[model samples]
Target: MSSLKPIRKAVFPVAGLGTRFLPATKAIPKELLPIVDRPLIQYAVDEAREAGIEQMIFVTGRGKTAIVEHFDVAYELESTMAARGKEMSALGPTRATPGDIITVRQQVPMGLGHAIWCARAIVGDEPFAIFLPDELLIARNGGAGCMKQMVEAYGEVGGNIISVLEVPRDEVSNYGVIDPGERNGALTEVRGLVEKPPVEKAPSNRILSGRYILQPEVMRTLERQGKGAGGEIQLTDAMATMIGNQPFHALEFDGRRFDCGSKLGFVEATLTLALERADMGADVRAMAERLLNA
Candidate 1:
């Protein structure tokens, strides 16, 4: 196993146009869309911070200024809240100190690979993490957050690790399925990756989750990566090239993942997270039960 460097940097690719959400996203980036109280990106950033990430690099496009501002200190707002005797603890996790975050523009709408490659300079030659803000993962049962779990697994396996979740076999065709080699507990040695394969052809039900701990070399591969499925440069294509060359593993996350990019998924995440909150859980549960029965 290659000696892995401590993952100190995380890349958040927020450049997409978020066409799925339409008019609402026309003015606001989907990443800035609120799951309930916090925006989707906040969850990802909080997870990154929890996993010991020191630097955050956001690959943004037009209309993504909100994301940058969200991490910045709101001096006037803070002052107002302070004077009003309002507890500002809710805003604590959203703050990022100076020099902790760097934003780069992904001027063009390429793909996930291109958005990530745009941050290659800030990433340097270190192993970094990629967090998809649209994928909201909640670690339950006192388990670590998805990225935290991956970082722990990375410590042991010391290679490129991608978070995987076991989807139903019939749904495997909708994701980039992993070709499993060997399994050790929740870690599976990744032998190969098959992107959006037909259900009959999928290697396994385990599909790539949005969290990843990838080596810097993958960025180099993406530099010259050709457009794959959907005429977009695919990150999976770049990652697959390193399968045989490096130690690659898939970590099954101990959490529930919500695909918040879609309307249904976004609603589900909001309701689920709201239902989990201490302040609102009882009320939300009561309302949900009443609605379900009615």
Candidate 2:
């Protein structure tokens, strides 16, 4: 087996029904929510492409078929665009080369780990990347392409590596906190992980965000475990079990992460991204100033 098994596949666990964004998500999959112009899930797919992931494995649930269709080529639309000489504008990067996109149904509303397990056949015995569409990372360099960077690091250290960001102590309970041992610049050796621990009891402020380059072993662990916190088969619980056995580490991401799953975070991501657009910058800035003045 190759030491640095080519991370050619990416798994996206997008099965959550998005109860928080109800009514809006009642008919539409929350992954399809717009972050500016593109849906939240599109950003994750784009990130995977940038990281050289050859295949995308979406672990989706019912009412999430649209998520699959979004990546698929819209034959009628493409034909119309081509006829009108608007192919370039109508067809964005989403119309990727054929056979690059694939979707598997999670069937049940289990947790993240269960959703991921649905893609086991597609991921098949290789290290793979997992990107949650909810966490939209905005990088100064290029739209928070953290997974691309992690793939580079995973080449040197053939184990699980996840992109992490330090949240305030009070906010640590909101995420999976990492217990760090030795530090090697941007990469910190992960000793343990505690999922959504109480503020005072958190192991570290560094929390696992959306991006991850996990090894295949994690699948086995998730398979054996029962429902964890919240009566769901948690992904964090499985990752914590692999800490000492494998080379687990956290990459301190150098970017602004937006938790678009929440109303406030979604608004922030939209306004921030809108401000960066050359065409919209002036107007958005002026509006911000006006709001401040008011």
Candidate 2, residue 259: how far the Cα is off, in Å: 0.3
- Kindly list the per-residue Cα lDDT of model 2 for residues 73-144, writing each as its tens digit: 888988877899784663477776777888888888988889988888888788899999999986675544
Report how far off residue 149 is in candidate 2 (Å). Answer: 1.0
**lDDT for each residue of candidate 1 in 1-294, tens digit (9 for 90 to 100):** 356689999999999999999989999889989988899999999999999999999999988899989988999999999999999999898788999989999998888989999999999999999999988999997679999999999999888999999988999888888999999999999999988899999988999989999999998899988998778888999999999999999999998999998899999999988988899999999999999999
> Candidates' TM-scores?
0.97, 0.95
The list of candidate 1 runs beyond 4 A from truth reads: 1-3
RMSD of each: 1.3, 1.8
Predict model 1's lDDT versus the native. Answer: 0.92
* Cα lDDT listed for each candidate: 0.92, 0.87
Question: Where does the lowest 10-residue lDDT sum fall in candidate 1?
Answer: 1-10
